[model samples]
Target chain A: MSEEQDIKKIMHVMRRAPHGSIYTYEGLEMILIMAAYEQDLSVAFIGDGIYALKKDQDTAGIGIKGFSKTFMALDGYDVEKLYVDRQSLEERGLTEDDLVVDVEVMDASEIGRLMNEQDVVIHH
Target chain B: MNIGILLKEGPYNHQAADTAFKFAEAAIAKGHKVDAIFLYNDGVINATRLGDPPQDDRNIAARWTELSLKHGVEVLACIAASKRRGINDEVMIEGGEITGLGTLTDIAIRNDRLLTFGD
Candidate 1:
């Protein structure tokens, strides 16, 4: 068996704008399932993806359910390894307290290192 | 490199596809195996065979084709999404396939990991 044959780490990049974006919820759900089935899976929020992690996602006037709740559901699936770009959060004035789910804070430089470390890197 | 790139953006746009290409190149450079590249939504246009960019600009459409041909990369355009964009296999020049959500389902089931790139 070769190195590639053995599954290691999986990274999900969620960069889509939050309001009225299906990718935000759908993308998070996708990786959450992968992590549930696989042990070494991880997730990263980058660019506009960080918007998905906003502490309170208001979807009422938009006529949809808030997706931040989905982030909390990750625990049920055992999607424990989570990450978010500190700069992205800061640029948007979103502190860790603003995230619906708890996650490790990472800078772009740290994210660069993490991507290289992963066996599979999925950027949504 | 079993890269599952879910491009939700178009070819002419300066978004998902271009950024995805960079990641694909980086994966190859780092000796990763991208077994599959899946395009959903507007991404199906990547294989349109009629995306005629300006002569001086790099042919993004052809670049994708070359990537698959030159390397052993598997480029799959989602059938459902393709129909939405009118990018069916009938419009392909050659060696392109129209797939479905099941294709992405299979990649998630079979590959070591699935990564998605969207706009």
Candidate 2:
């Protein structure tokens, strides 16, 4: 197959809160490995998943290693397509400014449309 | 179409494994090729042969083993995830293998669709 055909559109959908569970953390690890393959990749933050990008998160009290800072490093891996649901942010009274990484805050419908275009959509 | 399934939850405690098995079975019945079932997260628990639920309940691990044997579908558990959960080759069900994420990446690339079943 040609290089163009080799490139697949893969989206990692995050819909869970961080620290409460290991889904989001393991999902991030999967993204890091897949990023090296140079596929067209994107990550969507929905529901409580938006909290994963919240700035100034302190996991020290919970005794879990803080990985919120790792979101800032995604850009270096060329996995820059970070998306956040606007309604989810508003529901939690957060704004793009409150996020640890720069992301395109979009309506859920817009994200849904993008999700339909992906060959793979994994939720964590 | 060739399909790959990513199952991220364990059996009994959650319905992901059962649902994935049903989906894979239906897909195969329709003549679709199920390339593999890649187990990650708590999904590695699905590959253990040590699970012996009540006789009335479904044997999730054995179901996967049967699916692989009958349909040539590969059952792969992530090595890192399996190790963390104390799952090894000795305890793995028949037809299940411990593999790396690189295999998952390849499955995602080569398959026409990659479906994830999780929380």
Candidate 3:
């Protein structure tokens, strides 16, 4: 497990909506697993990915399993670095207060800069 | 430097395969080693040799094959994802291979960078 000892900055970019596709949910599963390795991890919510953390999501209506609350469990996994795109939120008419998890609201440029610094960037 | 590529979407239906090919090409052009290209989910279709596009269109599967054939890049599709999508070795492109997720983890561990391309 010497290879596991090497820490890398891994950022999982979520750009798709939940339920409509499995990207967001699967992306969360990835983050949770990577977190166990204790690498420097961050999750970015951009485009429709912003909806993944929206509050009061009732998937019961859609007859699909809802895991919106899973975002909250990320903190316990030590993967607390979550970033939300400011422009994406505005385009979707949502605010920081509307999400289920507390996140650092950042501009696209800021996220892009951080993305450049990562050893891995997993886009979903 | 060694680099790993993770492609998560299929060809034609999305621009992910094109972008990933372009990125891999550029990386190799810059003298960086593209250690591997791991296909997951719908991305597994990119490795299928059965893809036959119109004469006027660019062939995504062929493009990946060219990358591997020319640059020695290992184009791999996840066995789990490939099986679910009916992508077995028989249908794999000349330079493509069906591999397990553990290989992806090894690629991540050994590479200097692991970049992802998707829709």
Model 2 residue B92 CA deviation (Å) reads 1.1
Candidate 2, RMSD to the unseen true structure: 1.2
- Per-residue CA lDDT of candidate 1, range A46-111, in tens? 877878877655778879767677778887787877888888888888888888888999889998
lDDT-wise, the better of 2 and 3 is: 2
User: Candidate 1 on B3-114: residue-level lDDT in tens?
Assistant: 5666677776747788887788788789887766777656778878876788898776776776687766778887756776788767763445677665565576566567
Calculate DockQ per candidate and list them: 0.22, 0.78, 0.34
Q: lDDT per model, in order?
A: 0.71, 0.94, 0.87
Judged by TM-score relative to the true structure, which candidate is superior, 1 or 2? 2
**Where in model 2 is the C-alpha error above 4 Å?**
none
Please state the error at residue B24 of candidate 3 in Å: 3.1
TM-score of chain A of each: 0.85, 0.97, 0.95
- As a whole number from 0 to 100, the lDDT of residue A69 in candidate 2 is 90
**How do the residues B24-111 of candidate 3 rate in per-residue lDDT, one tens digit apiece?**
9898999999999999878998988887799999988888888889889999998877887899989999999998766776677679
- What lDDT tens digits, residue by residue, belong to model 2 across residues A1-124? 3579778999998988988889999899889888888889999999999999999998889998989998899999999999999999999999999999999999999999999899888888
Question: What lDDT score goes with residue A58 in model 3?
Answer: 92
C-alpha positional error of residue A12 in candidate 2 after TM-score superposition, expressed in Å: 0.5
How many angstroms is residue B105 displaced in model 2 relative to the true structure, after the best TM-score fit? 1.5
Highest DockQ: give the candidate number. Answer: 2
Task: List the pairs of residues colliding in candidate 2.
Answer: none
